[model samples]
Target chain A: GAGVSQSPSNKVTEKGKDVELRCDPISGHTALYWYRQRLGQGLEFLIYFQGNSAPDKSGLPSDRFSAERTGESVSTLTIQRTQQEDSAVYLCASSLGQGLSYEQYFGPGTRLTVT
Target chain B: AQSVTQLDSQVPVFEEAPVELRCNYSSSVSVYLFWYVQYPNQGLQLLLKYLSGSTLVKGINGFEAEFNKSQTSFHLRKPSVHISDTAEYFCAVISVSGGYQKVTFGIGTKLQVIP
Candidate 1:
């Protein structure tokens, strides 16, 4: 893809249900990132992946939230037991390199709603 | 550890008027600053970034920002805003190490340009 792409533009589920979000980053991008934006709130960092290196999960809110990336191409974020607080727009971004100065390209984001 | 603060939650201005969105950041180490804009039902797009060199950085749509090291602030400004410039603006900072590259975002400021 020419840019970062996210799946399932919107998802509605009951509380405590599990959900999965997918992200396909731009081709040749070595760094991928996940973020969450609650309604009228700032974006919260979730996780980051740099090529085959170990992913940094320090940003994950809890054990219920986990993410995985395969060979720097595609990634998936899973929420085991979703809560109302989990309702937000899940955003995915990819960068050409691993430096903080590198520019990031973002996806359209997936809106998740927990009723 | 880093944090960004956007003082104003919303700013309303008339078309052809100038506008400024204030952003402040706190970090123990050197970091890069960025500004992103999000339209309705869309993802974030990088407006500009300040890495090094001159303190003044110009970006798309005639937007520019200045990095003030003494004040720890990077405020975005536009000479004249158009109706199409209405959007949510976010300020972000990435750590110098870039290992995790955690981007801490501000609560965003909604810019409304009325004709």
Candidate 2:
């Protein structure tokens, strides 16, 4: 892909249900990131993946939030038993990851609405 | 730990008018700074970054940012803005070591360029 691609531009799911969001990073990019944005609010860091290394899951809000990446190409974010507060735009980004100056490229984002 | 703060929630400017969006951050060590813009229903796009060297950094869309280490700020500025500039601007900071350190984002400031 020419850019980072995300699945399901908009998702409307019932509360307590589970949803999985996918992110396909730019080709050969070694770093992938996930972020959450509430309505009219700041972005909250979720997780980050660097190649085949262990992902940094420090920002996952709870145990219900988890993510995985394979071969540093595609990643998936799963929110189990979603809550009302989980409704937000989930954004994925990728970067070269070699230097401190690598600027991330972002996807269109998946807007999730919990009802 | 790292965190970012965007003081203003909204800013309105007339077309061709100058504008500034303020951002601040806190980190224990030297960090890289960045500014990203999110247009309506789109993903975030990197506006600029200050990894090292000069404090001033130029970016696409006629946007620029000044990295102030003393003030712990990275403020985005434009000499003139267009109606198309209406969007949400976010400031971010990450560790200089890189590698999956989740970038912390500010709350974001909505730039409204009015005609």
Candidate 3:
């Protein structure tokens, strides 16, 4: 029983470059979530996916930020033409969908730096 | 609109001493409350949650929080905190609307446990 896992652990890109952060959640978890944490702030909800339902992308700051989860296994969060403000830790979490199981398992986030 | 507020941005306490971190939220409808801990360079981990039942909810790492509906506050408490307790704590609220779950988080409270 492994917990959620994120790739790269760190990402460094230029101001105008694009970056993609990947997340691999635990098996059989039907709900996935993405969050961002700035340097000295709390976690900010970015998006959430529950099974085949349409994702809740309202938390996304702008249209430039987009995420996609393939079939409930992996998710990728992409930032286009990243800006300095886009630098933050992107975290992924998984939970048992349906019912009232709100307990989520988190992964070590990917630290993104836009220089 | 729902929002979370964490007044104290930082709290310093001696090892083995009791500690308290306050959290408050404003919402007209029902909501699920949660407390999460984030170690340095790690993702957020669930500390406790208050959905229904007992107002005083106990969580991992000797942490507990009392949910006060009248006060609209959920304050986390630990009788004896260790050095390992030094981390960032976040209070979050999730409410469903329009067939989507919306999560709102407060500015994290950094706990510094002194030796």
TM-score for candidate 2, residues paired by index: 0.94
Whole-model Cα lDDT per candidate?
Answer: 0.92, 0.89, 0.92
Better of 2 and 3 by DockQ: 2
Q: Where does candidate 2 chain A have its weakest 10-residue lDDT segment?
A: A95-104
- Which of candidates 1 and 2 is the stronger one according to TM-score? 1
For candidate 3, give the lDDT of residue B90: 91
In order, the candidates keep a fraction of the true contacts of 0.79, 0.91, 0.79
Tell me the TM-score for chain B of model 2: 0.93
Better of 1 and 3 by TM-score: 1
lDDT tens digits by residue: candidate 2, B1-109: 7889899999999999999999999999888899999998777898888888989999999999999888999999999999999999999988855444657889999
lDDT of 3 by residue, A1-63 (tens): 899999989999999998999999999999899999888878888999988899989889999
Error of 3 at A27 (Å): 1.3
The list of candidate 2 runs beyond 4 A from truth reads: B97-100
| Local distance difference test, candidate 1 | 0.92
* Candidate 1: residue pairs that collide: none
Q: What is the Cα root-mean-square deviation between model 3 and the actual structure?
A: 1.3
Worst 10 residues of 1 chain B by lDDT: B94-103
Tens digits of per-residue lDDT, candidate 2, A21-98, equal 999999889989999988988889899888788888888999999998989788999999999999999999999885
- Cα lDDT of model 1 by residue, A15-56, tens digit: 999999999999999999999999999889899898887888
Better of 1 and 2 by DockQ: 2
